[model samples]
Target: MPEGPSKTAEYVATFRAVESARPEGERLFSDPYAASFLDGKLRLGAALARNGMGQRLVCRYIDRNWPGSRPSAVIRTRLIDDAVTAAIEGGAEQLAILGAGYDTRGLRLPAAREIPVFELDQPPTQERKKQRLRARDGDLPSNVTYVPFDLLDEGVGAPLERAGFRTGLKSVYIWEGVLSYLTPEAVDQTLAWITASGAPGSRLVYTYVDVALLKQGGEDEPPWSSQVAKVGEPFRYGLDPAKMDAFLGDRGLKPVWDQSTLEAIAQHAVPGGRNAPGFYRVAEAEVLPDR
Candidate 1:
């Protein structure tokens, strides 16, 4: 992976999104603009992904090097997409993407016109993404705003307020492929902020890995945890799936849907693909009305 804040390892998720819609008949969600974020390199990965062996070779390298990122990237993208769209249809008025690294949903989704999107990340990644977006379209969509957020240094509530996030409008908050890199306490703080800040009936769509595997000698730690640690971005936050409901309830977020890898595979994995227990899961939660 690249050096900091989900650099090279982060881009892999984008590449895998492009791969999801290859060859024609076998496809998942279609993201034509996913390549624009890549500066054209994902097309190369798409070529490599054409055949079974080449695809396996590319994925194998990512697995050995990055550990367990592929499945969550693939599955969570689709699930979050669904959750966000559903939220919007159900009266969501804004989108807040936490750790939004090169994600093009705001640019590509038609509903982007229906609500403003706020992409929050570290400054460097956000700057680069802005430059790339400018080069491709001359300027960003008027409804799309870029916000710099250092999750370690701060949480979203303050930055989002500064960026004009409406506290009264229902919103869909997307926290994908990011919690594992955060400390558990920070995760709790962030979720607490979302629960307390978002309007009643707002929704949060997030992905988190299993906490047991992340702890010392837990039942299902992903083998990639060590490689990820070696790269200096070891996991600090995780949630035991069994306790996830209570965890969210405590934070004033109600679990609406939670999908394990087994369910994701049966529902969305490409036909007969071999994916290790990336154990990453996608969930949707509702902000409880103020009592």
Candidate 2:
């Protein structure tokens, strides 16, 4: 079957846009270009509007239980924000976003203005996102770059390297909402490449669903997950938190933060409502042994 645009991509764009549009006091994080990217997708926009009820439910649940729960969308935004901030602080000259499907961070984040941001994705998806941004008059940050390639293909790393990514310079790598779409082997291979290619102190921020969650199949499934399953790209990979930490530790990387930590940050940022349970876990690791 020919691979067409995944509905999951559209859903993600909508979710981000909704969260971005929230008022300052109520918002967990912001993505200025999210709404722009979904400009023509009336169905998606409508779906997102309808999902507002679910978001409210999630917010209430988080408020009661977690007290300071950070929705997954907020968690992801903060993770990327931290990664970008850390890269800039550590003097990283480049930033790479893997599987950057319709993501607006490259254009929306102010830190991107100084550090070169490279977005790597398939040609078709990248083209579609580029067109959407252009139509929206979204201003691509001056330092942002786009690399089109299939990460699953052999020699996938070459394009990134050619796009000004170096082996010995501080860098930040983000792979949000991506690993679950890939097979286990591919996930490991991608990690290995990042570990091998990145400079000391480089950081990577990524999210993966828990395998146990997938097996149990509870009411916790995000509304978009079932719809995304209709397409061939159901979530497939889950990282055992303990094993994931050890795996990266062996590669000279140390897990510095996780979902719980972000949840705390969110509590402080947007203190009241029920936040969404983290159906997905986000972690940040640095490319050096723990102190």
lDDT of 1 by residue, 200-280 (tens): 899998888777666654544456676566667677778888997788888887889887654686766553335536366
Task: Kindly list the per-residue Cα lDDT of model 2 for residues 32-114, writing each as its tens digit.
Answer: 66665554543344334436574565445434533322345555676677677767777777788998987777666667676
Range of the 10 consecutive residues with the lowest summed lDDT in candidate 1: 1-10
Compare the candidates by lDDT and give the number of the best one: 1
lDDT of 1 at 67: 47
- Which residue runs does candidate 2 get wrong by more than 4 Å? 39-70, 138-141, 217-225, 260-275, 289-291
Q: What's the CA error at residue 63 for candidate 1, in Å? A: 5.6
TM-score of each candidate? 0.86, 0.81
What does the lDDT come to for candidate 1? 0.72
RMSD of model 1, in Å?
A: 3.1
Q: What is the lDDT of residue 217 in candidate 1?
A: 49
